[model samples]
Target: MNACIVLCLALTAFLANAVAQYETCVADTAIVTGGTPGVTVSIGRDEANEMVQITLVGPSDVWFGHGFDGLVMANNYGFIVDTSGVSERRFGTGYSVPTELATTSIVGTPETSIVGGDRTVVIERPYSATDA
Candidate 1:
């Protein structure tokens, strides 16, 4: 009976993962040019929790963020790299606002790193019904 229970648990885990993989949607890759040449951004979403994942690859020591409603405006979340090569997540509102740290409805860890001469950042957050 113990062996059977273990097998069932393993199968259950496998099935759950399979279902999650099937519900994932990947957006088209976006190419960005300018200060950080060859920069590419890709976004993906999973139906389970409407979680969105953003991946960015660009030149090292560059900052990147996703702006909603406009460029560098409110509802923007991104990562900034200081001169010492340390990266930190930052949330801000647009200049038109009161110039304060904007609140975010996103839920997850946003991180950035420099690897192989490329800067990579991955951010994940669930979709808020009020976001739209």
Candidate 2:
């Protein structure tokens, strides 16, 4: 098993305002059959800024992230945040640390905090970034 291996996601996109400081409403709900408890991944669109905000919450001892627009880790553009509130916009290429693309422009900073033994990382980036 690989990424999203232990944790499964049931993605749903809603084009409406979300509750509690979200720009747009979209989430990956947990399935009762076999889902990772106390884990969540939520995506919201910041229409005013033309960006997307990803909010992830999970165990405070490990790192977590979300990737999109590709098939495999190496093919995707993603943000990975460690437990200490450090994050990177990485273009994965292997099992080791990923490298950021030279032509890509990552916007804003990733924020992470641990409370109640849960780590929450929030990242914002351009909705459609240029590779050139």
Candidate 3:
């Protein structure tokens, strides 16, 4: 669906942000489509800390997710989000449910909130994977 593609575009943009800080990093935003109310995506780059902050706000009633690097699920990396929050990062090779990553990749703790029938999920990660 178009909405799903828009959400995925957010992730794809963030993926490009992995190497975006050639100079001062600026935050970017987009009003996502597809959802009844629509979703808002914000991506901020932390040049000093080499991190990227991504925020997604969407309807609380239905679960949503962001997929990166691939249009289809095959070998796609993504995560599911709900009112509760993100549980884990996942990778998939098919249309079925993706399995959690063997190792944690999040640079720091993620935060979430649900208010007024809207769910907001904020995730922060380094430009690269966290050190093992």
Every candidate's lDDT: 0.54, 0.63, 0.66
Clashing pairs in 2: none
2 or 3, which is superior by lDDT? 3
Per-residue alpha-carbon lDDT of candidate 3 for residues 10-107, written as tens digits (9 for 90 to 100): 99998997744533233333332342345666777777778777777777898876666565556756667875667555565557667767776675
Candidate 3 residue 85 Cα shift, in angstroms, is 2.2
Is 1 or 2 the stronger prediction by TM-score?
2
Pick by lDDT: which candidate is best?
Answer: 3
Off by over 4 Å in 2: 1-22, 28-38, 92-97, 101-106
After superposition, candidate 1 runs with Cα above 4 Å error: 1-28, 31-36, 70-101, 129-132
Backbone clashes (count) for model 1: 0
Task: Please report the candidate that would top TM-score against the real structure.
Answer: 3
Candidate 2, residues 14-50, lDDT tens digits: the string is: 3223323446576854322243477677888867767
lDDT of 1 by residue, 1-132 (tens): 999999999999999877533233544344333334456667777767677776667667555433344344455544443334323234444454322234554455557677798777665666652433
Error of 2 at 132 (Å): 10
Superposed by TM-score, candidate 1 places the C-alpha of residue 38 at a distance from the truth, in angstroms, of 2.7
Model 1 residue 124 lDDT? 65
